[model samples]
Target: MGRIGNIINRKGKQDAKRASVFTKHARAITVAAKEGGADPEYNAALKTTIDKAKADNMPNDNIKRAIDKGAGAGGGEDYFSNTYEGYGPGGVAVIVETLTDNKNRTAGNIRYYFDKNGGNLGTTGCVGFMFDRKGQILIAAENVSEEQLMDDALEAGADDIITEEDGFEVVTAPEDFNAVRDALVEKGYEFVSADIKLIPQTTTVLDNEGQVKAMEKLIDLLEDDDDVQNVYHNWEITE
Candidate 1:
């Protein structure tokens, strides 16, 4: 499996809890809409969130309601974006992105999770330099030709393309993501997953079983949080 495939498999496990997954997606959408305007055309963040929600198969009604809530058409609690960087067992870099109305509660919970799982939350930018922000779009390899995909993706301003056993990962510069995705869509390509992500520059492997277990638990705990939208890590997990 490729990096995108690995992500898909991990998400597949998380998707088993359908309600929780939808709730997280909804929260992200609302936060994006709240920070930017409700109109996606004028709000790149909102557009990206909406696209991610759609890719996850979130219902249109739920998406609309979340947008309305954030846009103030339906008054709701305000949420703020918070990013927490940390190191897990084996010194693996981890970045948690969240949207929460209560910073104290979220921060406390996040810190507790890390502390309890053999990790420690670090100051901002501590582990940030270890990763690069990029746009990733995943397309299944079932019937698609790798050469054609590379040709189209490169033409659409994509930065690179990775061929995996199960799919194709089209990478793009953050600024060119929206245009590249849109161009692909116009050309009738469908996505398995598409989002701006923090891609790790290097990966850490835990040879000790205890540290591996701790790292896995740490990721699970972070991902299960209602306020946490994303948990990026540099741990090289094997199947």
Candidate 2:
């Protein structure tokens, strides 16, 4: 499995953190709806965001309210999507995605987290070039046969499919993501996790224990912040 897959799996098991997870998803949904339209049928981005939120078991009511809030059916704060690039411990490339009404507060918090953990935030695109944006869909191995999935996924326009011990990872180009995912869904396939993600081209490994601890802390702090939606890093975490 990819590093992002591992992170998703770990987060999925953290039932205690469900509230925070939902908050992030909700924020993303609102942003997608506001940028595009609230109607998922007319808005591809909103549709994809809704699918992901549902996969995470976000409440239907919460999803509706988020859409309504974004559509201006109800009054809500205007949220701006921001991306921050940085180097974590051991020169690991990191990208942080956030949705916030207050950019200054979010920027300060992100910079502080990086500095406190032996990392330094950098200008936009500083570490972004180290990654590629793609759509990644993970499905449990027990849910489908490898042969069947391979045929279906390829026919649906996926770029590649990787079989992992616990699941299958279906990859698609950014432009083809919505079509491929929707096609698979129409065929009755369910995903364990599905979303557009930044896949790192090369990874960095921290040999020093202190660096590893700092990196882990940095990630935890970023994820815990309500403003942060996603954090991508080229840190090769091993068991």
Top candidate on lDDT is 1
- Each model's lDDT comes to 0.89, 0.88
What local lDDT does model 1 show for residue 87? 91
**Model 1, range 1-239, lDDT digits (tens) per residue?**
56657776877987787788889888888878878889999999998888888877899999999999988898888888899999998789999999888999999999999999889999999999999999989998877989999999999999999887788989999999999999999988988878889999999989999999899899888888888999999988765
| lDDT per residue (tens digit) for residues 1-239 in model 2 | 65446756676655568898888888888888888989999999888888877877789999999999888888788888899999999899999999899999999999999999999999998999999999998887765999999999999999999987777889999999998888889988878778889999998888999999999899989989999988999998874
Q: Against the true structure, whose TM-score is highest?
A: 1
TM-score of every candidate:
0.94, 0.93
Off by over 4 Å in 1: none
When summed lDDT is taken over every stretch of 10 residues in candidate 1, the lowest stretch is: 1-10
**Candidate 1: C-alpha lDDT:** 0.89
